[model samples]
Target chain A: MLRGICLEVPPGALVRIEGGNGGGKSTLLRLVAGIDAPTEGRVGGRPPRTAYVPERFPVALPLTALSYLTHLGRVHGLGRAEAARRAAHWLDRFGAAGHARTPMAELSKGTSQKVAVVQALLAGPDLLVLDEAWTGLDARARSELDLAVAERTAAGAAVVFVDHDPARLAGVSDAHYRVEGTGLAPVAPVAPVVPAVAPGSRVRIRAAAAPGSVLPPGLSGRPGPDGAVVLTVDAARSDEVLRTLLGARPPWHVRTVEELP
Target chain B: MTALLRYQGALLLRSQRWLAPFVAYAAFVAVGIRPGDPVLDSLGYAAAGLVPLAAWLVRICVTNEPGAARDCAAAAAGPVRVHAAALLTGLAGALLTGALAAAAALLVCDRAATGPGAAAVAGALVTVVCALTGSAVGALSGRPLVRRRGYGILAAALGSLLALVLAPSPARGAVSALVSGARSGTAEVPLTALAVALALAAATGTAACLAAARRG
Candidate 1:
């Protein structure tokens, strides 16, 4: 039973939701996805093309994966051929294209999850809400979903997700909120964690913007105690991120630069 | 809306959940109507059988999708729309069954009692009235309204029984008109009953759709 909760997800933003079991995180996601209407107050600005993945995909539907996704794509307002094309593409991307003709009930758990994820991604929705959507995925599919989330946000869509894994999309999320006892509290964004990159290949930059000045849209990081921000970027892109910071009007002051061993 | 309907229709068809109610309706028609039966009486019996069959079919469609799949569809298309689509699919299936039964009765029953054309038209209207009334019972008996499978089925059975026997029910009025018309050897369209059933179904559908969104 959440109350007095207000969240705004801007275009291209990735919002991560954290909470204990039965903390209303799923409830909040459902409201955001427009699956369940709030009894009080209002959830506005929901795009018509919103898609959601529920926490569990334990279904024994008679439909084959491809047909189900195609139907969902159509429900999302795609033409039949276009819907089928996109469904096949997403299925293949998730490595479940081989199971396209298999009945959903006969598919393995991981494959069923892939189909669930594919349905949401196929339509390219403006708002994507996921509740523990990666729970049953294999390692490869999990990373694929991470990439899919990144791609969605990169394409200027708002993505809201809840997962048991704290490290999932840790650094890439634009904002974090915890549902605590019927109220929402914002948690400071964490430093980006790029798992594929070795420790030696990462760079950390510390900078502080002038008071009343906002950071560049492309730069995101954790807030330091003294009002400074620490951004961790790929070593290759550190120079570009720094150039944007220093090149701004009344430019940010770069306090320190370091390489992690 | 069309897409939703198509998806729901596919779910109904592919799931094979339609078999039970459909076979039940067919059995009811086969047992109640005979080749030598009066045309109007047989048509009335066939239409009356549709009330329970429609209610059962709507229940199946409304609850066919698992919770997670339903949520997915609800998110893609609003929950109200998903619920409405399920209701319409079940109603459409019931209507189709009702038409087939009525046509079979027109073929086998003795048509000498009344003009075949008028009887066919009247049977079609009466079929519509019963199907709409059954749909109303169905929409109110499933999912958000009843929730429990045992209680929902019980409600549907009782609701269908009441819709058939209760004097105020549009289905009852329409079926009675057809049965009495068999005696008078005349066809009655039951237009007023049809209007009432339509309104009843619309109200029931609106209530069910709102409940789906709220309860979800």
Candidate 2:
């Protein structure tokens, strides 16, 4: 039931999509990952080299874990020996070395999830779309995943992941947006109240210098019900406001607050 | 084409569990057919009968995963022609395997009467036809329209017809005519017919690949 939702994720950033079940969170991930198309609206962006791990693990055949991973690498255009070597290395790192030669079907659910994670990581894609990727991992495995993701981001890869446990990704994510009613709205930052200004009271603004820059066009400031001024500053005048505000002497307090629409 | 051949061959070898039993059954049928002056006729019949079986195997391989048809479309390979070449190569392997089984049976029956060269050529030709037909049918099995009762009816009718045509016949004129024609060194029919069949098969397989690629 989604409609006309648009979002732009910047390069080299981690985006966390949070929402209740049956709310199209997975659908959005699938669309972004290029696994599915949007019913309406156009999605435009560079087709980032991406790897997607679905909520349900898809293991091809009953081949050994190493064999399957190696095959996946080859499918993605990796050479034979190099694919094998990389797969082996990741398997060992994910504590799956002992089961490397074992058929994938024989592995437990948690073990299979570990293999999926290593496969996605080994691809080293420009974007990683994960759907509940942390569902069945042990604590150590989870830590390894965090380190791996951090390393990827440091090396300039973007990631979008969906997880039920928000606490696990608290500090790792750069931005978190919840899917609500076919659209996304940023999670507003909590603002500290200014006790100095009473609600419903009008304050006169002393010239303070006869409007040094004529308050540049398209720059308007209005007070909200909570007595906080919301400034719709034009991008061209943003630098002017910053210069004027920051250059002011003591007794002047400036706090930037973002509002959710 | 090389990649497709190598991948299909590896898959075949790894999934030897089901194929091994099938190969055994084919061997049993090949041996059970008695050898005599009518052996060539019997072989022609047997080769034709194998068409449906070959088709079933191809169907299993292609449709093993419900999503495979769609996945195949999305593969980042070059043109659809390349995929078509690969599929044909894989089918060739399957056909060759069947031909080998038939050749083994012919060798065991009467090496003196059935020269190795003739057996090889005939087996190869028959295998090629069966393999192509089988692959085409298998490809259709994944189509929504064919997945219905229509495909079932078609399969049953085709299977029954092949079995009947391949059944041994000791009839006089047509059988004698074919045998004499085969021996008279009139190589044109078999050679030309095989070449034409192979060309058609390649074209059809290519078409299927292109369709899949476009859909993907």
Question: What are the DockQ scores of the candidates, in order?
Answer: 0.61, 0.05
TM-score of each: 0.86, 0.63
By DockQ, the best candidate is: 1
Instruction: Evaluate all candidate structures by whole-model CA lDDT and list the values in order.
Output: 0.92, 0.57
Clashes (backbone N, CA, C under 3 Å), per candidate, total: 1, 2
Worst 10 residues of 2 chain A by lDDT: A203-212
Scored by Cα lDDT, where does model 2 land?
0.57
lDDT of 2 by residue, B173-216 (tens): 22233345445532112544455445645665666565544332
lDDT of 1 by residue, B6-55 (tens): 99999899999899888888898989999989999999999999999999
Off by over 4 Å in 1: A191-261
Q: Return the lDDT, model 1, position A200.
A: 50
